[model samples]
Target: MFRNIVVGLSGGVDSAVAALLLKRKGFNVTAVFLRNWDTADETGKCLADEDYKDAEYISKKINIPLVEVNFVKEYWHEVFTYLLESYEGGYTPNPDIMCNKNIKFKKFYNFARENLKADAIATGHYARSSFGPYLEDYKPGAKVKLLHAVNQKKDQTFFLSQVSQESLQRCMFPLGEMMKTDVKKLAVEAGLGVIAQKPESMGICFIGTRTFQNFIPQYLENKPGNFINYETGEVVGQHQGIHCWTLGQGCRIAGSSEKLFVLRKDIKTNDIFVVPGTDHPALFSRILITSKPHWICEEPESLIDSWTVLNCEYRFQRNEKLCPCRVYKSSNNKLIIVSEKEKRAISPGQFVVLYLNDECLGSAPITHAGPSLHSLGEGEITSDVDDNDGLLRASTV
Candidate 1:
């Protein structure tokens, strides 16, 4: 039903192939290059200039008009600000999720419809939709399910869990059924061989080559704190900032050789608790509490029913395998998730994406993970987890 399409062409292999595929399908395709990072502040040179030049060449080769738009200010306000606040508050936020929600789907979607008069905005993401790759069955008031891409290794649906249903109905993922290797092969066949040779971009773009510790300090204050051993409650070391460490991440002590991992962040006390070794029980959490969920299409019927709890599959990180879990609705719209298995380093501030097989139900930002093996007694594994400060039965809470 829709024809005019604006593809996010970043000169990368995936996007080049995406634009090529849509253009071959006889749709009017426009390549949009988004400049989100401003390198003038510190780098002195424009880091994204090379990327734009490649995009220009790719668009010309594909015979599509290329338009460059600057969303540097929008990205800072929408994605970067949230990242700083989450870190300062002792949470490991997923800015990639927010980038899709606020910038790519929201800002870019709007720009395409308003400026370019496109019927839909397409992305190079390895994800699919129940409405078809081109959103052929999309309707104004109907719900659309976000399905996983056939290539699970390159699946990006987790990053799009917070996407609104409206934007989803107007979006297309051209790489849904294509593998990374296949995408590169197609790019090479399209005479865009250089694009296929480009290295895949990872993590936050503005940080570039700098380590997390090095780049974060430039924006956040250096509030030093003590690193206490969770088991001994003894000050093991000091850190420049609690924001620098995340749950389950490694911690190094000056002059000490024992490897330690983060257990918890006491934001009020300004202390980060650590335990020696990656296999420490103190690093595993069996239960997690989350903020309100944002369902892309509609609330699952069972969730909306009077049923107090329902079983589902969930994962915090994209690479982590989904775990069977019981979901409970707590007071104030919070969700209590009892993971069937002990999850290592379930950090607060992470977005927990829920799935029912291949379809993404929704996602919620993690607020707390608790009842670590260190705190629970042996028999409490099942009973104690259900009675955790009365939070165990979130449906009643």
Candidate 2:
């Protein structure tokens, strides 16, 4: 068993409980509070100061030493730069995913193992793995697969889809099988009721309380664009930037008998195509082409053979229901996914996380959504092909 364990306390009930559990399990626990953001609130006060104080309270009461580390430079290089590029490229990217991939799992993992000289690390994330929680059943140098938490309501595997294999093997999730209600109950029982009652934090970590539409303009110039109706190609209104809009959401434009929703965004033309209603046929996508996938483990054996079509489940949004899909090779050998049912608002730059029952297989960003149900006849629309290289018209889907 690992003697020295480092637990990341986020100043929430979740991480507090995680560290408490590790201490109770007879491990030497050290609490580390990471300061990843250097931003200030509207009042010009450091946004993370409160979180740090709460973390200190939890560590003090739990009788564990607390340490603070700043990763502002590492965070900017790994996560922030990617966010800027993805937004400038006209794709809405999720920074939280990048944070897990680069910060929590990679940077933080290395810090704990080398700097802290710890045998293992733990977090409050509601995720499990093929390697048991706390790694009681893991063998050295063996493979590990991230799995869905028993608490489906709080399952965070989608955010962890991009984590590396090494990180998965050494991390522990004490809350994997515990319910939120039970976790809070335990926190209260442990005399940490003040920590247990804190409201869950939300939004981009650095953005803090500011709306996305507002916070982004501070970093990137607001390039002007036009909202063109998909059916008529008539300019409805002007938008500050394509970065401000997302597919399948209400378009806040002026003077229309009906409200508009985004259908497609053309980065080169600086134009956004819109539909009349939220349920517009153009809003639904049945297929999407993706970049090469980043599998948490090795590529599934089912896909080891070239040109093999694999049946799997996928979710674009973290909380989205797992929808049935088929992943196969395209005529250009691109990774293509066709859904059993048309999905609404499938956007470019968003990742499609693949799954097999409970285990997270991997994820790939949607490079080109095949074509909305109602095609605009523009952009990189795709059609699937047979193994023999003949084009199979996926448009009829």
lDDT scores in order: 0.86, 0.84
Tens digits of lDDT, candidate 2, 267-286: 89889999898888778767
Off by over 4 Å in 1: 40-45, 305-307, 378-380, 386-390, 393-397
Q: What is model 1's C-alpha RMSD?
A: 2.2
In the range 6-50, model 1's lDDT, one tens digit per residue, is 999877888889999999999999999998886743556566887
Query: Which candidate number would show the highest TM-score if scored against the true structure?
Result: 1
Give all TM-scores, in the order shown.
0.95, 0.94
Residue 330 displacement in candidate 2 (angstroms): 5.2
**Model 1: pairs clashing at backbone N, Cα or C within 3 Å:** none
RMSD of each: 2.2, 3.1
